[model samples]
Target: MEAENKKLDQFTKEVIQDAGLATPSVDFLANVMAEVSKEKVPVKVYKPLINKVGWLIIGTLFLIFSFVLTRFSLGFSILGDWDLSSLMLEKHEINVDIPITYAYCFFFLLIFVIIQITMISKRFSRSLEN
Candidate 1:
């Protein structure tokens, strides 16, 4: 029995030695890296309801409207009781006096609108490029 066990162990060892070490192909790493670096299909992400150009136009219109409203509300008198022909004929001198707080608020709103417009346009351009 002991001789038979020894012979079986020797046979198993010889079989394992004959198999030797298994290795991957030489280009295995390069092939994996190439697959990892391959470009994928770009996906379009929807963000806002309006497009960049639409937002820009809307911002511009809002800016103009706000300026006109502010000017009129601040001091510029509307044609209330003056006849248009008489007012046009006479040399009219208009004076505009803007308070510091109002001026600051208007400027802040203007800056905010400009920044929003710029960001929207930039995002739109980037999306187009992708």
Candidate 2:
């Protein structure tokens, strides 16, 4: 027990000495407390009508943004076709604009994202109802 006590005392003393070496001035702590005390508490802004309108605008923007993005992305294949021409698999120039593959992929991803968001929204709405 005495040996353990001596080891613990030595460790504690070492930690204290190390901490003391890195200690900030008392004035720094005083200034920090003063600054904290001078700061104002943040106010929560609430306007039910404005909030509803804001959300409507945001929802509209998201829908339009998704529509435009999907439209462009579906047309992405025309910019540059992947060079599958190296091997004896037959060199072919792909015209992306008429291709249905990009359209299919775009629709699939959009559907998946919409379904996931709908599920989450539904779950939250259900919880709110309960």
Candidate 3:
């Protein structure tokens, strides 16, 4: 059984070699030089201005949503009404200024506007420079 298995392995290797499917010879130095040459040249991909503007707007909207969700989680707490003096506490009180959601949304909207303005100004400056 062992001899038969060895013969089968030898036959398989010979068949693969005869099919011109043998492993390639190493060209280590040549491959390195080719890769180095490729690195020296920069590859450019062009995107239309409209597409980029669309993506920027979408990202700004997502940022605004996340800010609102975070504020909503932090500002609201609920508990059942119970006798205040039951636990022998002298006084109990809760103070909330404003709905956190509105404040957070407004703040982030302001920031998003500022960033957009800055980016636009910079882009215009670069265009003028060229």
Candidate 4:
């Protein structure tokens, strides 16, 4: 079995060497490039998954939900017979006195990060368009 395998491998090598290497025509690259250049390159237009109208609707719904929740918490029952008073959540207040300077620093850092993210996204979008 080993001898047969060796013979087969030798035969395969001989046949391949006899066939020699295949080469493309001198103008193969040029022809391919010419055809490629003639083809139309599709322009990709960026579309937001959630448009302005969608965002506006979402924000409006969020406000409405918040208002309803606030009213419910303040004993304003939407359902007349059913009482939701028992489901009232307790509000815990933490009295941690953070320094004014620390708050200011945090605020400024948040603003800086937001600005940086905005700038980077804009630059990235512009690059994609190009």
TM-score against native, each model: 0.33, 0.28, 0.26, 0.52
Candidate 3's TM-score reads 0.26
Candidate 1 per-residue C-alpha lDDT over 20-50 given as tens digits, one digit per residue, 9 for 90 to 100: 9999999999999899889687877656789
Stretches > 4 Å off in candidate 4:
1-37, 73-96
Tell me, by TM-score, which candidate is best. 4
lDDT of 2 by residue, 1-130 (tens): 9999999999999999887866678799899999999998765543356587799999999988766554444434443853222322234455457569888999999999999999998887776555
Per lDDT, the best of the predicted structures is 4
Worst 10-residue lDDT window for candidate 1 reads 81-90
**Model 2, which residues run further than 4 Å from truth?**
1-50, 56-98
Clashes of 1: 0
Clashes of 4: 0
Which regions of candidate 1 fall more than 4 Å away from where they truly are? 1-90
> RMSD of candidate 3 to the true fold?
17.1
User: Residue-wise lDDT of candidate 3 within 1-130, one digit each (tens)?
Assistant: 9999999999999998889856555997898788888785443444457697799998999988766543334333344443322333234355568889999999999999999999998887776555
C-alpha displacement of 18 in model 1, angstroms?
Answer: 36
Query: What is candidate 1's local distance difference test score?
Result: 0.80
Error of 3 at 66 (Å): 38
Among all windows of 10 consecutive residues in model 3, the one with the lowest summed lDDT is 82-91
Residue pairs clashing in model 1 are none
